[model samples]
Target chain A: MPTEGHTGRKIIYDEDGKPCRSCNTLLDFKFATGRITSRAALPERAGRESRTIPAQELIPGSKSYAKVEPPDVVELGNSSWNLLHSITATYPSKPSEQKKAEMKQFLTIFSHIYPCSWCARDFEKFIEQNAPKVDSREDLGRWMCEAHNAVNEKLGKEKFDCNFWAKRWKDGWDEN
Target chain B: MPTEGHTGRKIIYDEDGKPCRSCNTLLDFKFATGRITSRAALPERAGRESRTIPAQELIPGSKSYAKVEPPDVVELGNSSWNLLHSITATYPSKPSEQKKAEMKQFLTIFSHIYPCSWCARDFEKFIEQNAPKVDSREDLGRWMCEAHNAVNEKLGKEKFDCNFWAKRWKDGWDEN
Candidate 1:
């Protein structure tokens, strides 16, 4: 699971040298020229080297499909944060012990199965270090905010006002 | 939890008249005034109705805050579908039985905790009828495609060509 922002490249070779289920693409894995670093081997000059390429590459006759695409980090971060915040916002206020256990297990499994390799690793490390707070809604919500802030910090983005979780996820802004 | 498109109205209330943690926004189970048919009672002339008043109402100066926000179904659906598709696209081809079991359990729990009440119910029903096929990567991926297609049909969207799971998710196009 190569993470985003890594300069090193990884290969996904199949024993039969066949197309893999990695996003259903037939990645040659090794460059046609014999190395993972060759630019000429790519069907699209992917902006990122994550294992699964974006689906737009599969579209026919789309000349600039690769150029306009957002980098993997941006898309992954946006999608991940949106889902995670929603989950936290919906956490029970005073969850039962079983509920708490289920949530913890969910996070652990989520980290393992998450799509991006490096992002998943980072999440697992964060969970190990901070642990999830599932006993109450408030605790889980705050922990989620903190977890997101940590990612933001890594990406050099400004911290969100955690108090505004309700506004950000549950309520529309004042103008709305 | 109200689903999308019921009289086009959504409901977010619990039987006990307490917020049921469907995404954690505090939905007043009933309106200040009665008559479930009063669209005029809505703060924002909501396109659909579900209980959670948007947090804008809680802001310091929002005298009319509760009048405007619709329930969170649309956003949740968009976000959730994006992530789940991604997850299935990247599933391992030869998953172990334990891995399969975990995935099934995860979906069961996910349905229960999902924010919208009616949407969750629909999902549970879908699972009960179809059941997940996590025995192999292909089975699970196909199941995911069908599950998503079910939602798409409800929303009146065109059915995606399920054959393109690899192309849509794992691989870029043939040119890639």
Candidate 2:
């Protein structure tokens, strides 16, 4: 039987009956499926760096693959946010009708097909509640910042102040 | 007058007549606009870490924002590739018709509004030449790898072997 995820939604499983890798944190999936050999072997957290198996353990000719661990939920989220924030940072202050429509459509499709089922559902709900503000760069940046803060809060991370979204994502911090 | 970009596409400018940050590399934009007073001040490359202004230069109470530099073309590309590969890594081996359609739409829209105008155009052309294969996880992963390798070749970077795409993105390298 598939396990109930913390989100109260039933966690999805693959055709092989394995818990969906993208939909659950690595440790939670391992524990729920009884893959962990012992409690002591549990990682401190599901961080990419912490879990990366050394390249020496890999097959020959794979030395170049060092530190290239498959992403867990946290790592994937971090990379996705980096791309999302950067995209908005460079968005035109005054976008054309086509640009605005494309951005809106991109976000909608992204929310629907994101690999993490539960996380995607949460984001879809968030978008429904706070529609994307794509009229201008500033509006979109602030909206993205707020959206990120919502995720941060859910993940128990620090919330970034939306006022500095532009500085953080665009125009580098002032030097001198 | 706005400068011609390397891709032969006219570089876009914002309403302020400034070169679009997302359309050209930071150093290229700076140089074309004569924002760089001296060639010696030019960065080795448009890397996020290479050009991050120290937190000490930022406003007070912003020390926590260290290392959060505005992304340049290279940085944005790196993050975007990470997200794209990870998404494909977690894709279902056998997807529903709805899932396949959604994935295709997501990639098409992504290719349209990918922030970097020239890069987006190149990706759009690549997609036109090689339609996204969404029939299975393996198909999608290979397609994404080839797409990334196309960009890598264009940028003079080493190509990743597609044979190990699964090991690099889906399963961890074997340990012991």
Candidate 3:
């Protein structure tokens, strides 16, 4: 079946002497009704030829052929993932570097208060895991809550006052 | 109460000479505890004066404070209310340039599909109304689905197809 003009001919091609590819009919005459009116059957000799062609073996000039290059692989110490992941696992991406550094500085300011070794370790691990997810500086409130809770749980301390976390993060604890 | 330390000596200043800002009690020795500690109460005169300082104002300076800058005003032009509304809205101070570019590109592509007509007006309106709340590129798919569905309904066309949207995007039809 012919499928040349699915949505009515809208003058896609200029009217000179171009033949329609599907119908193989001359499209030189302008129709008074402004509609496609001609249709043609395949020529006898043209109908005998095999149309199937393997895609890979087809002409290099064909649109379907594309030269794909293999992706680059980077080795990270023992295992290989990608350079970005390695960097992030170690430190953080450039965008989050500031926040990471702030957390480190905040840790430094409050270092004296966190006397219990276990509490400190747990707090660091908790912050490292959660800080990158913080979208805004205000999100530090949530981080402090989680860190305080984690530390208190680790040290077997009764729910440490939330004020300790909030005050330390806020005041930088009398940097004198 | 006597806020001072041993020997009736003002415990405010201990042998090591480190005074606790909170209680004004002299610290005996310093240790790198690596965690926040609670300060003991200080003498009335000093403690009352210091407590008045706001915690938010005392946070140590970080890159967030240094880097945060006001956003430039964006002007909306002839487009869907969604696109216009998104353009006119304020974004976070630190929105990544890539994100803004992607938004601009999406709007550009959308403009081509809706073109300069009322047909795309609803999509523009919808996007503008919703863009501020969108946090990531993945969220855009949902917005597009809803916006396109609304536009299609308004135009009396078939339901918007994601495949068709992708094809139109790939073909660069809406880019113009």
Best by TM-score: 2
State which candidate, 1 or 3, has the greater lDDT.
1
How are the candidates ranked when ordered by TM-score, highest leading? Answer: 2, 1, 3
Residues A2-97, candidate 2, lDDT per residue (tens digit)?
477432445556445755433344344445566553544544432533465566755456433453556545456766887798788667789999
Per-residue lDDT of model 3, residues A1-176, tens digit only = 22244225332221333321211212311221133454332243244333444676433444332222111100010011111111122221233655555444434322322222233355566656765343434344444455545644653544534344423322123321
lDDT for model 2 comes to 0.69
lDDT for model 1, please: 0.58
Instruction: Find the 10 residues in a row with the least total lDDT in model 1 chain B.
Output: B20-29
Q: Highest DockQ: give the candidate number.
A: 2
| Residue-level lDDT for B35 in candidate 3 | 21
Measured against the true two-chain complex, the DockQ scores of the candidates, in the order shown, are 0.06, 0.16, 0.01
Write the residue-wise lDDT of candidate 1 on B21-51 in tens digits. Answer: 2211112212211223343443542543345
What's the lDDT for residue A38 in model 1?
45
Compute fnat per model.
0.11, 0.39, 0.00
TM-scores across all candidates? 0.59, 0.64, 0.19
Regions more than 4 Å wrong, model 1: A1-71, B1-71
